[model samples]
Target: MRRGVRTEEMQEQERSKSGLLLRGRLAKELGQHDEAAKLFGEAAALEEALAQAYAAQGISEQVWRHEFSAAGCWFQAGNFLRSLELCDKLMATPDAPETLRERARSYAQTLRERRDRLWTELLQSEHTLVAA
Candidate 1:
């Protein structure tokens, strides 16, 4: 295969991941949470596979972004733990951008705080309801 053709093929595969990621984002924006979650999960798997493949070729920011977006989709869907795992993975990689690392840190902190507060409120409300 010509080098150019091979590069095109790789890019095409990369784009398939991106397409699914975009579909998930769009579906979520349209209030189709279930569809969005399914698409996001598929996109996440594809992005993860692509990231590993590209890592073997060389560290590439584009591949990292695919993984980032997949995780971000989960974050947007309130899957904080999964998103935190992805963020931690990205942040630990030497290839990740400083900005991305910082953002991931910020997001992880926010998610932790938010989930805690939400649970606290829920517990308090439940306690009150039980007493009533």
Candidate 2:
């Protein structure tokens, strides 16, 4: 039946999503940040695709979670701008849960502070080099 096929397809997609998340976690634990970031990004894309297929089914919760995970991955990978962009996306979503929005705001602040510190350190190093 059509319903059975759709159910099976959804289950398969869920499995794939889980696998990606698990692998991304493992990569992060192992300090393979770039790989973890790539895997998380893929998982986020898959979540978006699944959302499209389901026509907004559980859209707000799922999108916020996936985006948050991807944003964390980007942060770990030192891609601050991308992480901040994802945080911004989450914050801008009208239907996002309050908890998710709070997390995004926190992450954005952390990213901004981290970026500013890195820039200052870099500028200091450059100045030292020029003076030397």
Candidate 3:
């Protein structure tokens, strides 16, 4: 109930949100897709909680980063089909920005191509090994 306590809580909450986003970004950069996805999911959850808090406080913009995190998770996991589906869904969602949608689309396309090429190479390698 103390004013100083409330201020401290708000600051701590902001720091927590920022920390989650930073951790997720770092994980993704390190090519730790599984870890990145978990971090992103955690970040998204925190953002959703913050959004709900804002809504309760009568704020218009409930800024949640779930879509971006989810899209990144799918892309990082090499689940190109899922990534594409999510990208399309996010594109249609009013809360998702056009820039985010475009980013998702780009990532989805890249993942799909990469997955296809990798599979083809793997098959060829297996065939060669069998013959040998």
Candidate 4:
């Protein structure tokens, strides 16, 4: 096998981030949305833990990258609030890269709008029920 090629032994050794992401993408392509989301959520959580560890070690680039990745995975999993929370934190990090900060800002807006829309729809449905 080539240097970077994955082997069976490597696969059996751990549920690594790349493996989880690959599995999640496979599940998504199989139309198993919930399963894919679950896998993505797990990936997101793992990324978050990595980010926290990097942060503790004062590695700004790795921390920002992992945080952004975790936020993206949460978004894929439809966990908007968690994604938005991480995005917001990234946006607020003064030392984080501008590109990532810009992306986070954009994600935050979309997440906020989505959250507000859900709340508004729920309220409207309740009002309709009460009126009826």
Query: Which candidate has the highest TM-score of all?
Result: 4
Off by over 4 Å in 2: 1-58
Please write out the lDDT profile of model 1 over residues 7-35, one tens digit for every residue.
Answer: 56567777886798789889989999988
Per-residue accuracy of model 3 over 72-130 as CA lDDT, tens digit each: 55555445665566667656666556777677667667767888999999999999999
Q: lDDT of model 3 at residue 107?
A: 68
Q: For model 4, how does the per-residue alpha-carbon lDDT over 64-124 read when each residue is reduced to its tens digit?
A: 8888889989988989889989999998888778988998998889888988998899999
Writing each residue's lDDT as its tens digit, candidate 2 over 43-103 gives 7666656655554454445556767876775675567887898899889887778888998
| Clashes, model 2 | 0
State how far residue 18 of model 4 sits from its true place (Å): 1.2
TM-score of each: 0.71, 0.65, 0.50, 0.75
- Candidate number achieving the greatest lDDT relative to the actual structure: 4
For the record, the alpha-carbon RMSD of candidate 1 to the native fold, in angstroms, is 4.1
lDDT of 1 at 23: 90
Worst 10 residues of 4 by lDDT: 1-10
For all candidates in order, the CA lDDT equals 0.74, 0.75, 0.61, 0.82
Report RMSD for candidate 2.
Answer: 4.6
Candidate with better lDDT, 1 vs 4: 4
